[model samples]
Target: MSGQPTKFLVPLLLPISWLFAGLVAIRRALYQHGFYKQETLPVPVIVVGNVMVGGVGKTPITMALVNHLKAQGLRVGVLSRGYGRKTSSTLAVSPSSQSQNVGDEPLLIARSCQVPVFVGNSRVDAGRALLSLYPDVQVLVCDDGLQHWPLARDLELCVFDERGVGNGHLLPAGPLREAWPRKALRHATSGQEVPCLVLRTAGIAGPHEFAVQRHLADFAVQANGAKRSLSSWWDTPVQALAGIAKPEKFFAMLREQGLNVTHSQALPDHADLQNLHIDTAQGDVLCTEKDAVKLWAHHPQAWAVPLQTTLPTELLAAIDFHLAAAQHAKLSSPHGHQTA
Candidate 1:
């Protein structure tokens, strides 16, 4: 259903959406009232997620944040729920980890960032596991856990794409998973409200949100880590396919790069590509880096285009400011001092 409810369906779904909102509110209240426990790790956690369901470029942003943190000389680790994986147990993600076991996104992060990553059904558990093994990691980045109230975060980065809060309704009625300008959440340990930052991954920047510049990398990568300039395919026809929340966006980006996309396939988000068959006779195959992690096993020749993202310096400075404060507070705490 494209995650956006049609005008005709909105009216029919409004009642159910209201019920869903009530449930979400109740869940939040439970956590806030201490009825449900929230776990906090020793290292600060920065959650990159979106209020709307579906991908809004959170993975790329998460990777970018990890790289930025690493450049600042801080040891960084990643935690994820490992969505779409077959296993429910917590497992450390390695570059060699199969997408079916550790999830495509987590594996991609592990390989792309070359940092420690762990995944489980519960992000809290995943964070604990990651820290247990990588005790030196100074910070943790939760890939997609805006609504995961169980694991408290020191900073929240709410991401948005071109479709910002479409239809402005929740659940079946629209794309919103939570209300816009959501209320602040409390820290797991200190019980203080955690701060949030708004980031627009695409489209025009809102007055209060930071805008990120996103474009396909000039080069495409192969399974063996070989790279080829995208311009090499300018005159050659290629079959482009994407299994993402908004496949059209990827296809459109390819066209913008002047690639001759003769055939375009938009599969379901995180669609299994083990049996995907493309007629090479049509042209060379092109896919996104996320799909490449799985597609390489079946279509090793597929050239995966990586999406490069640039965040504003102001955003990084803001994050640094928050991290410093969070670290200071943690150090001053008796329990944190004892743990340290």
Candidate 2:
């Protein structure tokens, strides 16, 4: 099973999907009605997530946002649930941290951006942990926690790939983690629209959504920090390995780059590679950046392709505008000054 809900089977699964959606609605109601606690962190929180189940280029966007903010001299930290990690304890991610212990994505973010990143089951816990350790951090970015209502966010950016809402049904039927327009509309009912931005990671952007350009980096980085042009492997047959939500997308991107992928291995998202066999000697092994963290330990020769993105200037402006608004609102609040 691809773990994807089949389109043809959506009608059959609609009943179950409705049941799941009802449960989700109830959960949201619980949070909204004050039955559950939603924590507003001292620092402004920006959430980047997707309504669909699979990856929608959130990680790259997060990195881009972090870099953008860092260029402005703003201290930024990242928080994640650290999916697929072995440890349950909340810990600050560092270059020395193991991917299996803190998750591949968080480890990559920490190393690539050289910023504070904390991983745990709860975004609130991760945010607190990051701030407790790094008091100078000015902003917090929560990765893939759109459904986590317990953590109040100043801004939410929901990303979508070319798939666009795929059949427009909820889990076990379609690709959606929640209903599309209905979920977005739920926020509008509160007046003055939702504090969310819809973005298209690939393909044409919708009338109201922002479009981001994502592509493979021209060069691949080796474990020794050596650079190799992706074109170098164009003539030779290589094995493309991706352990991501959409491995085929990576394979397609490699093809687009003119790489001759004779073999492609689509592993489960965040598969435990500690014991996985990788015979790089068979041929050139190419992988996504997320897989490089663990694969490098075992196969240093593997080529890890990094993704480069061009974010819309308007999006950046909006983000800055909102951050300023949030800061001012926080400062003028009667809740007392809370820093760090």
Candidate 3:
């Protein structure tokens, strides 16, 4: 009985998965043949996403990359589809913007990175809108848009967690949103091949992949912007709540930090905690920063532990090379105009 479901579902889903692959191939062909158009922006776009489904720490990686670019004295902007947001209209994300309106991840990015972020269903539209408002922005970092073929990107960072391309199968059977080891993409306007780099966000990096180290910050933040050191919770019972894909990972990390987590609640990814009731008597409520964006509104007492990520210097160098090449190409083009 235990293995019966797997035997039944795998056979049932395999054919549909094959059909999905066919559709994906057809769509790629359309874009490759110019039947479908990919829009290009003036500034270079770096898309950070994953072929595998579910959250694989893409937001943390995106924030880290944005900060790195800013440190290099380049004015950077971010574009996102604003997944799970209430509104579909294009809008800029501000520190004051509600997660319900701008999406939790984008709101967190705007607050954390302190960079311009715009959300829209269309990445190209959001990119243009961001540029229109922040004309001096030198580059755009897309939060998650690897499969969004309509927007041309100069560089791609495919992020993966411990589950690297699970089962190596497509949806309905496996975790992949698209086929892995895909062919290179081309710049929509310039028709030049775009560069892609694989980043293993957790665990050991596979062959030809960069490694990203992620850990929780020593302190947790309150709704009012107050910081509490993790050491302060040593004596108190902790009730950890994570509304993320891999909540167990968060819980394990808390334990690793010597936290006494008495009660751990794993909510669905992007869950609306507005109506949900949390028992404070269990202990001190702790959550991920992504969850805190929305969770803080109703539960002001919840402490948000931010995930700190470190990227390889080699990865940054590779990105810098691509950015320089993109800049040269933009400058040499007769249609290019100065924005920075």
lDDT of 3 by residue, 198-254 (tens): 999877898899999999999999999899999988888999999888899999999
Estimate, for each residue in 1-340, the C-alpha lDDT of model 1 and write its tens digit: 3488769999999999999988999998898788999887887889999998888899999999999999999888999988899999999999999999999999999999999999988998988888777777888899998899898899999999888989999998988888876888988778788999999987899898999988999889999889999999998999999998889989999999999899999998888898888899989889999999999988899999999989899999999999989988877777562232
Error of 1 at 37 (Å): 0.8
The deviation in Å at residue 335 for candidate 1 is: 2.7
How much is the lDDT of residue 216 in candidate 2? 92
Q: Which candidate leads the pack in TM-score?
A: 1
The parts of candidate 1 lying over 4 Å away from their true place are 337-340
Model 2 lDDT tens row, 1-340: 2335656787889899899999988987787666887787877789999888867789989999999999989999999999899899988899879998999999999989999999989889889888888888889998889998888788888998888887777888777777777544222112223378888998789898999998899889989999999888877889989998889989999999998888889998888777878766558899999999988988888889998988899999999998887777667766533664
* lDDT (CA) per prediction: 0.90, 0.84, 0.88
What TM-scores do the predictions have?
0.96, 0.92, 0.96
What are the runs in model 3 whose C-alpha is more than 4 Å off? 1-8
Displacement of residue 130 (Cα, Å) in model 1 is: 1.1
Using lDDT, give the best candidate's number: 1
Backbone clash total for model 2 is: 0
